[model samples]
Target chain A: TQLLEQSPQFLSIQEGENLTVYCNSSSVFSSLQWYRQEPGEGPVLLVTVVTGGEVKKLKRLTFQFGDARKDSSLHITAAQTGDTGLYLCAGADSNYQLIWGAGTKLIIKP
Target chain B: GAGVSQSPSNKVTEKGKDVELRCDPISGHTALYWYRQSLGQGLEFLIYFQGNSAPDKSGLPSDRFSAERTGGSVSTLTIQRTQQEDSAVYLCASSLFFMQGILSVGELFFGEGSRLTVL
Candidate 1:
């Protein structure tokens, strides 16, 4: 079983639409991170939520960590075509190794 | 600052051949990790190196896979007797020592990944 499960393996929406992606797990994590990857490039860190119930905003994107530290969410508002990419969530296990989700491919078409 | 970098962006090798992929982590970073991403699949952890200590090789998929970090800077991941199933993009990441499992909160600086195809 995947330690981290991501919902909506794929997403397609028109420009300006808003959406949310989820990452869930029954295990608690020390911290959770979100990344965005474009074709032909490596993933880049978008945000990191450390504390339980913590929320972070990066311009048009918002990230929230579950109060129990077992889940997280990524929301985009007024999405633009540039927002299209693969969104990945990862958690740091107690061993310091990162457990990754399968990633959600988000396509914002104009 | 320069981010992580890998060599031979793309490679194609015959099945049963051996292949070595290299990674150059960011300067001053003491933690390095290797992972593989097969087509349409999630990233799978392979190995990790921290300072002069022994590496964590628990994630290696088989006995044919091995990795070593020299001088705590550059690392090489070797897959012996490569098989078709080994075709995938290999990614490398680096972070500061203190960021191992704490302060930096798992913020990884990733290289542009090496794509290997076993024919």
Candidate 2:
């Protein structure tokens, strides 16, 4: 069974649009992380949130961790073509074991 | 190298053949994990190794799948009698510190992954 689940398995939007991808789970996590991956390369870390109800912003991209630490969301504003790739979320269990989400494949059409 | 390394990057083999995939984590990383991904699918946990403790082999799909981390540095995953269903991209990741308790929720550094295609 998948411990963490992601929504909108595939997304296609025009440049300058806004979109939100969500990751949810029933189990609370000690830490949550977001990663972006391009073809032919490994996923790269975008941010890590350790506290519930915490939000982090990276330029036009905003990430929020749910108050109960059981969910997270990534919102991208004024999406650019460069943002086209796969967005993945991972949660760490008490034992430091990471449970990964299925991922959201985002495409920004110019 | 500065990042985790994996090879051979791509492998194509026939059924019943055996194959080996290798991973070299960044220097000083104590935790290593192996995951498999099908086309456009989520990662599937394979195995995990942390420091000196025995590996967590619960994730291994079957007896034909096995892995080893030698000298607490390099790792190798071996698949015997490969089947077409075994085709997937095998990913390796390492964290600098996971033994320090909840305080240090080490972020994983990943390799590009080795793509295996069993015919």
Candidate 3:
């Protein structure tokens, strides 16, 4: 089974602090996506990176797809309280099925 | 619908009982997916449906888990003999289509999810 492993399962930081979360896997993917989920709600898509070494930015969040397509990262610059949520990375396998990482729970305390 | 919708936002059932979760994808969406998320965990793919092709059941954990999509729109996932391990948030998502032939990857719109608890 293809597995997407995420690092730093939990993070608690003060508002304005920057943090980075990672997702890694041994298998290559056609694309990778980042999602943020608030409590009691399903995940909302943040961005999708299809090319190796690609980077996409959305407001204060920056997402990077690894050169090998086997990993990805999400960096939050000056995180705000609204950034508190679960961040998930999903890779599109060769079959077009999504392989999801366990996710990182980020708490940005104001 | 403007977005994916799931019914029975929360459910509590006995350990041996059965439960059914429903999903209504956005109109015209050709792809649908089912996933389970434990507390503080990522989504676990359960099943997938695309256009009229056969559904993907590879991610289902056991035979007791079954899902069906009717008329290529709404879907229902049924769990039999529920166990505590089955307690989790069941999420449904839909996309326009798979990204293979498309120029860009499609975004998946997810429902609020149905939270299931087995006791």
Best model per TM-score: 2
Q: What pairs collide in candidate 3?
A: none
Estimate, for each residue in A35-108, the C-alpha lDDT of model 2 and write its tens digit.
99888778889999989999999999999999999999999999999999989999989877789999999999
Docking class of 3: medium
Q: Candidate 1 vs candidate 2: which has greater lDDT?
A: 2
Off by over 4 Å in 3: B98-105
Candidate 2 local lDDT, residue B26 = 94
Question: Residue pairs in steric clash, candidate 2?
Answer: none
lDDT of 1 by residue, B51-91 (tens): 89899998999999999999989999999999999999999
Model 2 TM-score, 2 decimals: 0.96
State chain A's TM-score for model 2: 0.98
2 or 3: which has the higher DockQ? 3
What TM value does the first chain of each candidate achieve? 0.97, 0.98, 0.98
Relative to the true interface, what fraction of contacts does candidate 3 keep?
A: 0.78
Second chain alone, TM-score for each candidate: 0.92, 0.95, 0.94
Q: Each candidate's root-mean-square deviation in Å?
A: 1.8, 1.3, 1.5
State how far residue B116 of model 1 sits from its true place (Å): 0.3
TM-score of each: 0.95, 0.96, 0.95
Model 1 whole-model lDDT (C-alpha atoms): 0.91
- Tell me the whole-model lDDT of each prediction, alpha carbons only: 0.91, 0.93, 0.93
